[model samples]
Target: MAEHAHTHTSTPSPVPDLNRNRLPTLFEVLSRRTLPPVDLFSFYIYMRDQQRSVDYLDFWLDVAQHMSLCRHYVRELRRSVLVGTPEPEKDSKRSSAILQGLGEMSHHAGPSMYATEKERDQDAQMSAFLREDRPGAHDSPQSSNGPRNRPSPGISSSRDITSDSNSPAHTVARQDIRASAEKILYTFLLPGAEREITLPGSITQDVTTAIEEFGRDDPEVFDVAKDYVFQAMERDAFPGFLRMKALGNLIPATLIMRLILGLVSMFGGFWAAFILIFLNETRQTRLWLILPFTIGVYSLASYQYSLDPILALLGFSEYTPFNFSRVREPYVRKLLAQRAIMVLAVTILIDAALCVLFILVPGKRL
Candidate 1:
């Protein structure tokens, strides 16, 4: 039992929120990631739809994927190194191009290797189909039973060329690492990429220099750039993500109930204040109106007091904006929330004043 438990136990996923295993608190998302995170899809939606600055998340995930690929290649390289299997050499006489990875060994026979000029021409024609140039009507269609139709090469053979190559393990590993790093740099670090991260000039420069210097087969080539992007998202983007999830998690049944209650708490005072100030009817109505408005006032006040933290969490300053980064969607949302609460305050106060007037100096009964 102990051995089984030990063997099965693994590190917790960095993306539990994405996996839908558990939801972390706001503090965990913000504070915890600094030490490092998100529910992947939800956070992406929040950044994309609400924050309007999804490049932060996009760049982060891109680097994460690059890192994962790098690690995978590294593991495969290590295993191959341990096994010490000398890779096989290709037969030069075989056909050069392949539509798919595998077929009858005869299909691979080169046109040059055939016995006769007529057969060589035939082999060349068939080789076109094998070269994946599209398999349809041709000058020489195969005999009815012959292999005019080739089956799909299964997934496992996708890497057969690489697996059978004469190149040493290090050469393949180097190419994989170099290709991944260049792609990351092009997609994110380049000056005008479609989805660039826009790091500080120094940070981006450092990444370029590091990749140039020691990136060959180095899995951590992008670590520095990754850290900067992670910090940017952690400090600025993640809070809004947490709020989005919190609000989104409320089911329709629960949401409707909460909205009903929140609306009462939000606007009940204003509704009563309208009744008192504009449609004053009687003493009893005035007195009764006062109590609800008073409660509304309290609720709005409390919300207002707590609102600063919530706004801060929404990247209010950045969007408003602290960095003067292009102002965008979530700022509008934050502003709307603040204004709605202010309106509630105004209405509640008006009703409270009317109530005070009625109590302190009784108006004539109407």
Candidate 2:
């Protein structure tokens, strides 16, 4: 029997080199573009001051760079997962390596770091100052000046880059992040201006304004609009005309129903009043007529006032018009109530005139 031989070949990974000479220059550009590190508790003024000096092109470039770093990191992770080891090594070196890679990825997306008791006082003092100053010194994933994550990963691939750049979902997300950054940047740029930005109902605009204006000359109102803006963007898609058709039908249907009820009540009230006046000698006829007319009036008034208590008490709707078909709001019912009242009033007047005419003209009831 012949001895068998096997040849094994390993392919080199395509992860970008972090130690490239240009990387330091990139960090320098990033430092110039980004707002300088300041105490989160007292960062408003400092943020405004530092951000004003940012070069627009540099700012966008830095954003692009951050996006690229995240994209490359994800690609490397995907590759590693695809090339996973089939058998576990007892020493578990590969497991440790994978964990280290994951840690590096997390660091880029981590919240702004605060000093800890374990850190040397000097290191803590120098951390913010030296972050982008030393360039390659902090370029490592484990370093203090390591790159940060953007809202999305940047990739040159038509699919990834195109989706990030142009797809509605991704585009809106990037726009939100960009808009947040811009809000802070612009606020700092024009510190003396009084600008009012609309915020969502969740955040109190007055409180936000008060906090920002505590020490500043001009009260800069920072709206917690992100929750509002993103929520508006992410809301279940508009549902279009199909969803609206039912709602649209409601207004017209409401108006029509009210008009119908009003006409019926109006004519009924007129006839009953005529009959009661014609037969005034009978007490039972007068009592029966009054009870139903009062009920009909009450029912109509209640329907109008159900949505608008103020209007109900006032006995008229300010937001709605008298014409049934012209009303666009849910206030169609209110218009109907108004119409009912007018019809009842007119019927009473007519009945009074008919009684007077019969008495004066002679033999009118015949």
Candidate 3:
């Protein structure tokens, strides 16, 4: 029994060690053609979390600048766009003119052309039926066996394709899909770019307008899209400068600094409270330490809440789980600032009340 116990104690456990799984390589991502749009969005977020997206974007930007602006390269790119010609010249006219002319004429003539053709074909069939009949046509004129007496099954009918094309439901569905795609693109590929440039709804519209103007032709689309993106970035640059100026203003800066320093005080106060309570110090001293610590924590939270609008403006909202937007109105920001002050005051009052309770009930500190 002693030997068995010693053997059991010396033996190692057979539990497996779990390692962190690696993300897919760039090559692996690029090689898979069947990946869904959500996967691309996930990959983008992963790249951002890993802090590699910034460098990747910078590299691409440098490459784009070098490839797009050089005189010879630009000319070569234009030449490439103009090279392919599956569409024959008008003089060569690969498409049949007669068929095109008939289709065009059908638009104006309506269903009457079909009616006339149908009547002529019916008349020919009637004549053929008469030729094959026995010479008793007048006798069989009212008979069910006669071709003329029979109902014509060859009557042609046409449906108006134009009506379906012009339907309100069809138009609305197309618009909805387009809007959804734009939102997805902004959320996944170009996160925060829209907020920095324009308001949430307006940025996609601006991008669509740019595409409309420049995307009509293959040659101009890339250059125009690149320019529009840069233009948006430039627009945000001025506002960021203004924000920096606002941050420098002494009154606001002082408030922000005090709130920050209060966080440190909160840390120290927590430790002091813990020591006094656990080490059997006087109840009054313990209450003093705890009250300031509680007030400090609440104030710090309120301070961060007050800066939400500013953080949203700087495009940090995309990283958050829920939606957040910048308060474009100056009045709204002022209201939030006032609310923050009120919250801090409330927190202090609550802490003071708690301290009074602790004093009144000395045995109930826990």
Residues 1-366 of candidate 3: C-alpha lDDT, one tens digit per residue: 222221111112111112212222222222121121112222233233333332232222322222212211122222322343212322123222211222111111111122355433432332232223213222211212100111112211111111111112111211222233233234323536432322245544544443343221111222334344444433533233223222211123334765876678777775665555556667766667665667575656445543333342343222123333232223323444455455556766766765555443434234
Tell me how candidate 2 scores on lDDT: 0.30
Clashing pairs in 1: 99-130, 317-322
For 89-147, candidate 1 gives per-residue lDDT tens digits of 21122322221122221211111233455544443333232223212212222222211
Which tens-of-lDDT digit does each residue in 249-273 have in candidate 2? 1222344455566557656765776
lDDT for every model?
0.41, 0.30, 0.32
Question: By summed lDDT, which 10 consecutive residues of candidate 3 come out lowest?
Answer: 103-112
Q: Which one wins on TM-score? A: 1
- The C-alpha TM-scores of every prediction are 0.42, 0.22, 0.24
Model 2: per-residue Cα lDDT at residue 323? 18
Candidate 2 residue pairs that clash? 48-188
Report model 2's TM-score to 2 decimal places.
0.22
Error of 1 at 238 (Å): 4.7
